[model samples]
Target chain A: MRQNIITRFVLISLAAGLLSACSPVRDIRFRAHYHDANDLLYAAAQESDLPYLKAHLKDGGIVLFSESWDVDMQKEIVTGDGQHFDFNRRFVRDGEMVVSVDSVVIFETNKMPKNNDQSRISSLSVLGGLNTALGIYCLAVPKACFGSCPTFYLDGDQEFHYARAEGFSNAIAPGLEYTDIDALNIYTTTGGTFPLTMKNEAYETHNVRSLKLLAVPREEDQRVYHTQDDKFYLARQRVELTSARSGNDDVTYLLNKDDQTEYFSLADPDNLRSTEEVFLQFDNPGNIQQLGLVAGFRQSLMTTYLLYNAFDHMGNLYGDLLATVSIAEDDAPTIADVLYEQLGGISAYLRNSHKNEWVYQGTWYETGPIAINHQLMLLDAAHPEEEIHIKLEMNRGMWRLDYLHLTEIIEKVVPLEIQAERVYANKKHDEDLLQIMLDGDAYLVSQPGDTYRFEFELPAIHDDYELFLSATGFYMVWGREEWQKEKDLYSLYMMRHHPGRYLKKHAQAYKEYEKVMEEAFWGSRVKHQIISGHDK
Target chain B: MINKQVLLVLLMLLLAVSCSVPRGLPAPEELPYETKGTAFYVKLHDGSVYRGELIAAENDALYVLPAENQHPNMKRQSGVVQIPWDAVDNYRVYYAHGKSLVWFVPVYTIVTFSHGWFAFLTMPFNLIATLTAHFTSQHEHVLRKKDIAPEELGLFARFPQGIPTDVALQDII
Candidate 1:
């Protein structure tokens, strides 16, 4: 249904554009002419020419006398009983005088032209009206538009879901800049060089300090995973779930594979912070010392909506709000901390049969709605005969879990950091950008439509390696003109100081924009042309 | 099933186009000439131009209530000026009546930003459209002397029957 509406809108806009281009304004000209003074006098004497004569006589510079006046065409003389004036229309004297017709340099008149330029007038009126309406619409609902930092894409990946990672989403200011690592999930590669395309597909400026790959070596069946604390782990011997149930519904099929079919639940309408749990039972790997529960998950639109709502509330004061966040004291909780506390991450627990209780392991979370991030939570040691039962608890409707499994941890490993050797901006090699990425001293500033390809030389052409993207940068969001009218400092303060209350109050408002926001967001994506000679 | 954004855009488009075309001026004969005063830009044979309201006209001369505030030289005199038919040149009568359409500049500029990266194209198009409309409307209203005759212009004056001889020139001025 949404697709149909979008198609219709496109068609209508195209038709309007084509019509405007084809239609030209009609021309209308109102002109008059005379061969000489005698012809003008003869034409002026006729009754049929009375309208033009009257018009000219009224304001067409045909001098009028307070007394009667007569023109003798045969004698070529004009007599008038009135005040005489010079050539500049200055009064000379009030007297009866006779003037020669030969002294009359010219006799002229005018007519109001009929306006046949209706097409141009109508076109302009329509265009102006449309522009004003759109402007007002933008002023009413600014949040329906989408904006974010630089988005990275792999070769051959199609649509929004396939986006590899978003750089420094939380860092809205320079003071909060930090490095972000995302697992590329590209376990195998045949080429010697790894090419990654980074695009600034938002109305924002990106100041990227560095871009590199974290390659971790693993065997055929082993996979590398990162924890919430940024620790890397190599896990092997995967064990699929024997059963998975969320509120009595078996969802094992949804969580068994990393096929992008995610399992999710709706948020509690009354309270957005309400939590839910899913129970999973996996076969116990006998005598396994280190067991890790790997889960592939991504955030739902709840976070996106909340973040965008906060920005909307800031409005024209967004710069002031961001400044406060950036210059916050060390002991004070920043915006990130406040948001994280409001929407808690996913917590896992192991069911202990001996103690007859569920023991909390750890919570893991990564921001972004595009990429499904997989993190491994180390589970406590369990008895071999006992079934490995795990409970995954998280904020309702805040997360979408795509995959879950139990794996035996081999050992902790540090990834090989690979720096880009060459950088191509818009299909042309850029040495300055490459040097900026390598030196890490300055930033490679990118505007709204910039596209850069980073090529990294791999250590070896082996297929037994996993690649992860480590990007460090910060971005500044462009303030919309519509937002300037909505500036409310008190609301911004409420959002920063009391997020829970803010979220509760804004729930209904967010609900109004949430339904179509995702579609609009993706639909407004910046079109990036594919650069040849890039590896997938 | 239509998206809210799409619906809003369509509604605005409809509203805009519906109100786009302004009402045309009344026909020449239908005009209320009794209370309507006619102003004109009169050019002399010596190239001096004067703008004022029409007072009266005779066979060989025209009586004009010169706009003293507009012309510095006319500021010294406060009464009507009479020009001989021999010293007269062409003149244009002012009749255009409408509000200034320059408000569209800011409106269109604001709307341009909503087009995302496509703003590059929309900005220039909006500016050109707005400027053209403004200048065109101004040009469409003024009646040029070459296109009209002085005899017909009397119908658009304050007294279509011709200025009353009993009225004082000072009262008319």
Candidate 2:
């Protein structure tokens, strides 16, 4: 079905292109010439240069060509059978008319030019046709259009999937604004001026209050990771998995890299909360005192679909729902909590060889589908000799795991914070906005199509360091016009009041839009270009 | 697969660029006089203007077939108008080059969608290119009384070789 839909879309686009090749209208051309009365009289007097003319007289009558009419050049007079008219160009009578050559004022032609150009018309037709087709596509599937929060990029990467960080995705309202940190995966830099570009490529408006870089110093072969509780850890001696199996299939190769080639599964048809386990085995690095399992992963579109469904149900009342959440107390349970709890997260467990049983380690979870988030799951006092066996149990089809590795923990460390020294808004340096960012009180509101470049001077330390982006902001999703027609306040109520029941009831609807929505969402990713210099 | 898509896009771009050249109007010498009638707007000294096709010029007077009948109900009407040199004020003839800026809207919209999220950057660039094309293209040209001699415009008349004695004006214009 998915293949058929894609094929249909391509065929329609081709038809539109072909239809646009034909010009819709013919070009009209006009050629005009003018002559003064004196010029006409002078030319008329010259025997050798008598002007060929189509002439009209408005001396209160109409003049028609008659065989009997004659013009005597010597007498400079013309006599013809014609009609007379008032000064208003109205015709009065048709009779013998005589007029002197000196009485004429003006003589001109009123010929309409013929259509002569075909190339230009054809070009216009193609442009117009393509535009019409694109407009129809946008109208039909607005949900597929590019939309998200502020996305950050490093110097070299241009692809959307490789974005270094995405800021404040969960902060949908002003009151829900908070800071988010993501590892840049850059373990070493030359320690000079560092430039990071922030772009609002989506329809949402981003209110960025602050942006800074968190630099954590680490030795060679060591990587830094942050836990769910926001504790930074320096780890070394990373070990790749010997074998990884999800059910009966080996997925070791898929989870080998931080690249976007992810391993994902379809959601359980019967139940969304149904669990699946991936068993992992890695060569044990002797008896290490402290250990951490590093996992780079992100949620699948299941979460995004649910969020969009909830928003669609809220529809016109979405603003009110956001307002309620914004005004709620810090400790109060919100809809986000309910949804997260209902679906659950990836839980890590280790096998105790002596007891031959799986012991609980830890679980790490974050919401969003754009950026791949990394977290460390610390094991509790487990020292393995021969091999390390770990099991990751997660809701089926709820997550996409990109990279998984077991690392030996070095120690807990603090990040050295470096604030942006200069800020460029839409390629123009704004000193005032930079000051506001430093103050952390005012926000730099970015509308759609806005881009910001944050320049930070790296710390003076010489050792290699890991870089992470710390951005504080919240974004408001622009309500789509199509969603207004799908207002279901009762469904919104069910989602907020009884999420467990809501999930089961809404599963079928999500299933319908899942494939198309995913295709559209990824295909419509916003592309940005960074100019070499700050001035653009 | 990606290479084929890229090649297709490149081909389309090449086609668009090749056709984007602004077309110029045909020169007066190249104007097709035999196949088409040249229209003229004649303004008399009394401020009345008449539009028609030139029929013939003979013996210091000009004969024309007026485009419209001002008094269709009048009896005993002649189908051609005769004006001596002294009754004229000034006359003008023009040639309209077929070019329109209306296509810019759709072209820009298509470009925006094609660029996807990068439209913000490409939109401004597209606007500049469109405006440049519009301003540089010739739309129309007007030849005034001083621009060309009266005898020259006579070449565009309905019967430039002079009216045939046996033919009626209704059969020609």
Best by TM-score: 2
- TM-score evaluated only on chain B, model 2: 0.51
Least accurate 10 contiguous residues by lDDT in model 2 chain A:
A527-536
* lDDT tens per residue, model 1, A58-77: 22123333324456778976
lDDT of 2 by residue, A1-536 (tens): 24435645874664454333322222222333333444545644554433333343323112332334456667776676654443233456667877665543333322334332344445445545644554554443342345467888987664456677888877889888998888787757878899998887777789999888988877788888988777899899888878888766778887766665566665665556667888988887678888888898877678766776777887788888888888888777666777778888899999988889999988888777777888898987456677888999988767878779888898999999999999998789999989989987899899987888889998777567788888898998778777789899888788878887788776666655544444444434322111111111
**Number of clashing pairs per prediction, in order:** 31, 49
Q: Score residue A329 of candidate 1 by CA lDDT.
A: 75
Model 1 chain A: lowest-lDDT 10 consecutive positions: A527-536
Per-candidate TM-scores read 0.56, 0.60
Whole-model lDDT, candidate 1?
0.66
